[model samples]
Target: MTVHLPILEAFVKLGNYLTDFCENSYEKPSDTHSKFEMVITQAQHQNGWFTRENILFALKQWGDLLTEEHLTAWLSEYTLKYEESPKTIGIVMAGNIPMVGFHDFLCVLCSGNKVLAKLSSNDKVLLPFLAQYLIKQEPLLAERIEFTEGKLEGFDAVIATGSNNTSRYFEYYFGKKPNIIRKNRNSVAVLAGDETQEELQALGEDIFRYYGLGCRNVSKIYVPSDYDFEPFFTAIFKFSDIINQHKYANNYDYNKAVYLMSNFQIRDNGFLILKEDEGFVSPIAALFYSYYESEEALRKYLTENELQIQCVVSKQKNTDDVPFGETQKPNLNDYADGVDTLEFLLEL
Candidate 1:
C-alpha cells in the first residue's frame, strides 16, 4: 500500500512543531547563559535528566534532515517498493542520549507499522510529546502508535537497541520473535595527515555533540604514524567551552585524574586525548587510539574486523562512503549499519 498524503503531511507538521519548539521554547545560550544551569534545574538535582540545550541541539540537528520532501520520498520508496505494511513492531529504546529513539520510531511509522514503543525512563517525555503532536496533526496516527512502560508482547517483530552487556539479555528475551538486536557498536574516523583545517573543524561536531555520549560519536581515531597533532588540536580546540559545563568538566577531570593515577601513558593535545588501543568503542568523554604504519595496513585491519564495525567515516572513497559530519545524523535512506530494516519487515 502506498503511504497516504495525510500521513506524510502529519510527519511534516510534526517536524515543524519540533523545529518551532526548539527555536522558541527551548533554552538558548542567549536566554539561559549556561547549559549546565538548565541541566541541573531540569533534572531537579537528579542525575541523567538531559539538559534543555542538549535536547534542543539534537532535535534541531535532526530536524534539518527530516524535511517534508525527505519524509515523502522515504515513505514512497519503502512502502511502494518494499511492500512492508501494517507491521506490529516493538521498539526498545536507548536512554544514553535525548530522543535516541526518534529514528527507529520514524522507521516503524514509515514502514506502515503499529509502533509499540517501550521508552527509556531517561527519554520518556520528549518522544511522547512529539508523538502526541503528530497524532494531533492527524488523529489517525493515534490508533497506530502506542507508548507503554510494560513489557511488549503480541508484536510481529522487534528492533531492540542496548549496550553490549544488555544486548545479550535483549537477544535472549526477544530471540523467540523476529528481531534485529542492535548491540553496542561505535563509529570511527580514519584521519589521513592531509585533512584540511576545515574538515577537521566539521569532524569536531561529531566528537563533541551530546558530550560524546551517543554510539555514533567517533570514539576512536586511526591516524598515520608521526603525524603532526598541532593542526588537529588547533581545529578541535574551539570546543574548550565544553569544559565550562559542570557534568562534562567533571567527567574530563575524573578521567584525566584516573589516567594520571593509573600512570596510563596517553597522547593529549589539551582538549581530548588520543590513546593507542585496538578497540573501536571508547568510554564517553574518553577516546581510543590506534596508529597505522600505512593506509594499506589500516585497510587490512578494517577489512579483517568488518564484523566488529558499524559505520566508518573516511575521506578516501572506494566504497562504504558516508559524509564526515553525517555519521550521527543518518538520512532516511541510510539504514542502520547498512541493514535493510524495511526488507526484514516485508519478509515478516
Candidate 2:
C-alpha cells in the first residue's frame, strides 16, 4: 500500500521546526542543531557576505512566514492541481544573498512540479540542507527536488535569474522553452523629509541588510529638493558597525575614493555615502539620491521607470508603494519581476 503524504502540511511542520530551532537551538542542543550551526559556518566560509547573522535573519524571516495561516491565505487565491506527471522545471538562481532562489524552489514543488536547480556557487550550501529536511518530512520530495552542477537538460521549462547581460544570454538559449527570466532590478525609497527617527532607523534596515546586495535592498532614494540629511544620517547610525566587515569596508573605501577623484559632490556619514544620481542601481556602501521637485513629479518619474525598479519604499502605502522598511521582508505572494511564479508553474 502506498502511503499518502500531505505536502502542504509537511511544509507547515517544517515551518514550525525552523521557528523552534531558531528560537531554542542553543538552549536544547541536538544533532540537528549542531548540523545547522555547522552549515551556517560553512555558508559563511563559502560566501563572505553570508554572515551568520544575515543567514539567521533570512531563516527566521522564512520561518515566521511559512506558518499554516500565511501559507493557507497565500495559496487560497490560486486554484492548485497536482499533476499525475509533473513537468521538470530548471531554475537558475542568483547568489546576491542567502536562499534567494528558495521561493522559486518552493513554487516548483508546491505546484507539484520537479525542480532542477542550478545553484550559484556563492549560495550552494543552505538550500540543499533545507531540501534534505523537507525530503525527510515528506519522502516523496526526494524524487521532486534536484541540484544540478552541469548544464540543465530534460527540463520542460526554465526560470533563470541573473544580471542584465546574462539575461540576454538566457533569453537566447531558453527562448524556445517556456521560461521566466529575470534581469537586474533595484529598489528605491521616496523621502518626504518629515520621516520620524524610528521610521528612518527602520529604513536603514531596507538599505544595509545583506550589505545592500539583494534586489530588494533599497539602493536609491528620492528626497524633496530642500531635504536635510542630518536626521537621516543620525537615524541610520545604528547600522554603523556594518563597515567593520572587511568586504563592505573595502567597497566603502574604494567607492568613496572613486567618487572624490571623479569630483562628484557626495554626502558622507563616515560609513555610508549618498550621491546624487539618476540611476536606480548603486554601488555597495553608496546610495544614489535624486532631488524631486514634488511628490507628483516623483510619482511620474517612478511610473515611467517602473521596469528598472523592484519596489518603491515610501510612507504612503499605495497599491504599488512598499511601506518604509518592508521592502526586504516580502511576503510569499510578492513575486519578483512582478511575474507570478506559482501561476506559471501551475500552467506548465
- Point to the candidate with the largest TM-score: 2
**Against the unseen true structure, what C-alpha lDDT does each candidate score?**
0.74, 0.90
Instruction: Candidate 2: list runs displaced more than 4 Å.
Output: 1-5
- Residue by residue across 176-258, what tens digits does model 2's lDDT show? 99999999999999999999999999899999999999999999999999999999999999999999999999999999999
Q: For every model in order, what is the number of clashing pairs?
A: 0, 0
Where is model 1 more than 4 Å wrong at Cα? Answer: 24-49, 81-85
Question: What's the TM-score of each model vs. the native?
Answer: 0.88, 0.97
Q: Model 2 residue 42 lDDT? A: 95
Candidate 1 structure quality by residue, lDDT tens digits, 196-254: 98888877877888778777778888888887878988998888787777877777777
